[model samples]
Target: MSGAAVDAASGAPRRGEPRPKAAATNQQLRQQAVDRMIEAAIALIAVKGAAGLTLVDVGRAAGYSHTLPNYYFKSKNELLRQAYGRSVGAFRRRSGAWRRQALRAPVRDDALFSTMLAYVHGGCADPAGARAVNLIAAEAVTSLPGLLPEVRLQNERMLALLQDRIEAGACGTGAAEAPASIEALLVLAALRGLVSQHLLGVPAADVDAAVRMLHGFIEGGPAGGRSAA
Candidate 1:
């Protein structure tokens, strides 16, 4: 207790240093900075569009120095990619239970359909995240060519998820098999359109009605109506 505070059982401190929590503190602060920047980026993209995003703008929006985002992220494109990835990750987490339920009964088209519905509703549940996705995707098509690959990749992943479920059900004995790829494409395309409309300020009632009608179409045969010669 004379020179420096004793370590109790270990005697006195060697350098009289209290302790170093800088590593952990720095790590936590760094993570907090990253999270803020990413959230700012998402908010910006939701409003300004990905094509208009800049590292400086993101840093400022996060309430940090204009140079801070660049310090953490290599380039504007890199930041945009991370922001997009974060939004997608959030969407997946929100729908994780639905995905699990579908996986549990992979052979049931009804289960897959329900899961798809959950995904659509999940977007509604998180409008900001969904709007960020929609804006990023739209910009990827019209402007942000660099992000087009990512957009395309997400679409392919969605298609594959649907196809896998449909294929699994098709493989079942005495199952009413349809063309997996085509069926999956149709379902994904319709759902994506509906979700886009929802993000574009479409009335929730109308979107819900559309979703139900789409579900009915899916529940019906590939034809969905009329005589199938």
Candidate 2:
């Protein structure tokens, strides 16, 4: 009830604020706090990169006491790790169903095209998560050695999946100009580059054009029916 006391250490309520309603149980409240912190961390990583993110920043960004993040996550590394997982989860939730279906079947060239299109669009659907993933990925190489293995595994899995799709669909159609392995790496690299450029303030129209160009190249054109150079 509103009259119930919220523990001071919980930091769930500020001075004079009504206690959480009875319908919001303590477990639910705790989960809400953790989710908020994770989202705040993602936003911070999107803006400032994960290299310098602190638990205090996460707590404050989430509108909680600066110590609350530490109470929940303990360390910046752990917080960033969880934030990364949450970002990945959000992307999967956005586009996982069709992707799973596509990967399981013998996709045609058009299906592969649709799958690639979905990958690009899905990455942009959650701008915060996309930017956070890119920023965190950059940090993994230079500033966050502890995150290297995890980041590497994430990329390797993606590359492998793309290659499988390319082999199963595009290569079979003779539309692919390069080896499936090479095509997969190129597609993965292009996607990453597009995301990085967009995060660096590239105009959306230009980014869209580049995506179209990527689709064109995959379909045997340099740009939507033009011959390749």
**Tens digit of per-residue lDDT, candidate 2, span 45-139:** 99889987888888899999999998988888888888887887677666666566656678543655555655665677778899898888888
Across 73-150, the per-residue lDDT of candidate 1 in tens digits comes to: 978878878888899888888777655665677444465556576678778767778888888888888878788888
- Model 2 Cα shift for residue 155 (angstroms): 1.1
Q: Please, what is the TM-score per model?
A: 0.76, 0.73
Each prediction's RMSD over C-alphas, in Å, is 5.6, 8.8
lDDT, candidates in the order shown: 0.75, 0.76
lDDT at position 159, candidate 2: 82
Q: Report how far off residue 12 is in candidate 1 (Å).
A: 10
TM-score of 1: 0.76
lDDT of 2: 0.76
